[model samples]
Target: MKIVREARHRISELGKAAAYSKFGTDVARRILASPADSVVHKYVKTKGLEGSVRRLASESLPPGLYFAKLTIKQWEKHRGKPFRLLQGSSVVYGNEVEPPARGFPLEYRNIVVTSSDVTEFKLDINAPYELKIGRGAFTTPQQVKYDAQYGVKQYGDVFYSLRGNTVNPKKLLITFPGFGPSTSRISYAVSYLKDIKEADLRDTMMVCFQDRYLAAGSYMMVDSAGRSLYERVWSVLDGLRSEHNIDESQMLFFGASKGGSIAINYAKDFPQAHLLLAVPQMNLPYYFNKPFFRDNLFRNNAIRSSEQPESLLRQYFAEGRKIDYFYTNSDELSNHSLIELAHDVPNLTKYRVDGGHSAVARAALPSMLGIMRNFLHGAKNKTFRCENIRSYARGGNVLAQARVDNQASKIRGANWYLEGSLGRTKFMHLLTEHSYQFLKFTSDSQVLAAAYDPIEAMSGLTALEANGSRWTSSLPEPLTRGPKQSPGAVLSFDELVLTSTSPREYVVLDGDTHGKYRYRSYEVDPAGDTMEVHFVKDAALSVDTMLEANGKNRTSYVAVVEPLANWNLADLVALRFVIKAGAERLRIVLHDSSKRQMAMALLSQVDWKNSQVVAASPTQPEANGTSSAALHEKEALLSNAR
Candidate 1:
């Protein structure tokens, strides 16, 4: 019996070997003799990430295994054939029923998933042709037609992991994009559209504030009234919170430039709303400051502004009083004036950056987004960004001197380095960017005098008081006219007096104290010649280091010019300087959103620490403060960025 079994096994093995030999020979011969199909040639290489990775190493190989001569096209072809196309409902009874007749015949479309299925069914897009398996109709013309013509036909499967239950929806980050005057004209256009499915951000619930009257093609301003227009949309948001299941506590407000101003004003008026202001406008004075007679649009409307410029501006200015601006170092339009107003009002929080008007967008986008998420969800301990003069000055090869401009004489100084050259042109660029008024010296005169425009008083704009207030004796019109003198000796006789006519405000700029100095003499002639006396202003002038002339004499000043509502912030960080006297009299106060004082102190001499100041007075300018220990923490706080 064993011998008979062995004989059968041998016979079976020989038969298997013969079959394999024949199959191998046929495949080899076909490869060697037949011309390759164009489809196969085209599939010679792969594409995309999967193809690239596969070419580098096969999934089946060990970590160190070597892959050789593998083409990208060949590997990608493994996924050949388009995604499955489904037609007609897969319901059990769907195949048995006849499609109802109508203007368009009721029909069904089908999708094939597997290779075997594709082979069994064929796609014939010919006229009036029916797809038949046996003979019974399976689909309706309307259903099939809709699939072919209207449905999202080309996109692959979109899987959404439903996060945060419907009972408690996740916080909605409403980012209001700031378009120019022409674009943000209406409520619906500028709002984030809810129907776009092309991007993953589709779920973000973004609303754009676009120009309603003028399309994106025509750049124009809407003159009807931006405030009223925005209020309508804001009312919609209120409805969403009250009527719908919106997570009201999780709503975040974001804006830049004009939009920033709107966000801040809206939040200030509606303190109950959970909104994070990212680089809010310093003030709304910009719109009225520039003359506008061009066409402005409203809802399905158009109007020219030649008739009511003053009245329209008056309305706009009234709205400006309601906002609490938080700007940054990069804000060229409203940084200086915003910071000035911040000192007067406690609600404002200011930040500083190194970029232009878009600095907050560029530097603080991620941080602002995170904070907004927290604020909307009722998260606690949310922190914000503040300005860092030392770091900013380092970027422009300049120095920063900060002081408390209150009536007290408390002032301190520190040295800083701005990144750029202190050459003549660069200095002027910094001035314009920061809105620093140029002291018309007529020539390169050491004695610099700054003039002022009366309108500056209305806007809270401040510059050094006229040079007339800081001189004791008459000197040459331009210091260049006088003979050169020693670094310490007086070259020209000049009087120095400090006065504040607009308001009793302290000069807020770099280099106000006497402890640190880059150069020794106030009016020094480094290359000495025969000169009698050099006239000098009070050493306490508020001149930014970057704006300081780069001659042999490097003496700078910090004058308490009239207070301003807003000034360019980008220019402030670009300045740096060293303190030569009055380091003990410096004080900085940090305020909260309620127009209430939160923190105060003398400016820190440390590089980057959480510095605080004690309220030397029991009450602040607004009659709100406490008697607390004077503390200075030398660290960066987002809350102080403005």
Candidate 2:
């Protein structure tokens, strides 16, 4: 036994000498110079690759040599591990042995890869399998599973292309595609693969889902039963987690346009996942009205009525989940409702980019990746601060003074806007200005100030009022009231008189009301009747009617007015009227001769005492019907007509 041990030791020593001679002195230097905690040492110890290491010299030690030496059982053990350290071995082996060019065939584990052309390869995975490829390889293998009923259909293809070493990946990124089937699935996978490389996310798994098209060539995720496609998506993700043993906390969902809508919807299920959306259609009702989705509007509307991203976001916030939004300043795909939804969701992080809707993804990619990295590494919430906001009313104008301190490294400038019960206004350009004096003339009782960085576009509203009273950041408090002033000129309507006459030019307020000056109230069931018009006999000859809303129907008032032949009131700035109502809010709308809405305003408690109807100019018609822009033009037209 001693003689045999000596012979074996001699042979091992001779083999080591041969390896040293073949690989040169670099092998010894590398082993001696390597730190104990280095990846090479760790891979060697954990993988039990001491023999492989002893056989290889530093100069000839091919990339991924240790992984290449792993047996079937050993490889299965490290299947889900991060690929950063072992990815180099994916290339061909450098020594006498020639590695498989096509890499590990799926057939080795009940999976098959078939290729019509060498360029594009189709993979049939009997069960879920891990796929690892080089950094920029275009031959992406998408897993296509067969559904028993759907027999060879493409519906089961909505899954991610798994990359990297499957052994305990650091981050898992799931991407959702935009509307329609414009690009192939391979291109989408390649684009995200490049993004992963650019971010240097070493131990990462990428997931990309294909949007299925309907018979009408429209992207439809909702079934006939009004159920969302997110259910299937969640099921697939759950399967992936179970099969590959992925950590749920390290997941992220990203998409643009319609894909953004899906991401927002999926975010409700995975509250622990970090959501990233670009130019997302938050309101499906608004999206249904678009030209592309017009044909299926009614069906889509039914599905949208049940579930909306805005409502889902509220639920997500309730569960302590946050979302990251990337939108363009001039996105035609987004409407006022979508923007308002993004603005109101306090937990959502918004990033605004310049250019059209399609450019948002390209422009915001770098910053989006950085945020994902920080989130994966358990970084704290990154936000700026706006302090010392002093607001006071000066006559009809409210002036505000504040300072914005940028705490984030990526944000260079900030934009400011005012949000009130009336509505949000356009964001003012305050990218460089820190100390700003924003002046706006309005009758809104309360207003909340907000500031956002241009780069990341994450915004924060003023939580503290001018009086130093603390309020919720999500729901800001109103501004303080100013000194009261005398009332303006009032225009009073005639009393409600009932008269029976033939060829009635004006409709009687008691019962017979038709043609122009026909008033309708939505508060009553059978409208336009005698009982609908309430009469009050007093010194002021006032009228009182209850305006109550029930369920989906809102209280409204509509009055038809006849065109004046020669009368002119172009010089008048506003027409004021007295009103008293128990309801907290009301909307006053004015229509032209063609029944087209010309102007409108939101009346609150402040406007109840002195309700006014002001005409708006052509350029500023949306200024809550306060005044008109073409005042001189109207004056000239009135003089010439008279």
Q: Best candidate per lDDT, number? A: 2
**Candidate 2 error regions (>4 Å):** 1-159, 180-193, 198-201, 215-220, 223-228, 296-306, 332-346, 376-642
Indicate the worst ten consecutive residues by lDDT in candidate 1: 423-432
For each candidate in turn, give its C-alpha RMSD to the true structure in angstroms.
Answer: 31.1, 24.3
In the range 1-642, model 2's lDDT, one tens digit per residue, is 999999997997576456545344455336524675898778776887543453242222222211111112223343322211112322111111112223443122111111112223212212233442211112213321211111212223233444544565666777766652211222222124344552344566666555432211122355322345566767877766666676667788877776777777766656678787777765565445333233233234345455666566557655656676666545533522234223334455554444567776765555565566565444433334454344554553334444444332223322233323211221211121233232212123222122111211213242211112222122122344345522211111121122212111221111111111212222333222112121111112212233323333333322222222211211110111011111212223222212222222111111221132322233332323222222222211111100
Candidate 1 residue lDDT tens string, 1-642? 999999997897575344334343343333322343544223432322222221121111212211111011221232222111122322110111222232333233211112222233332211222333210112223323432332211110110111123233344444443543221111112323222222323233333333222122111123112112334445655644554455544455555654554454444334433444445433232221222211111111222222122232123233433222233433433432323222222222233333455654544443343343334333333111111211111211222221112221111111011111111111101111121211111111111111110111111111111111110111112111112221221111011112222222222222111111111123222232111111112222221221213443332332222113322121121111111111111122222213223211122222211222222222333234222222234422323311
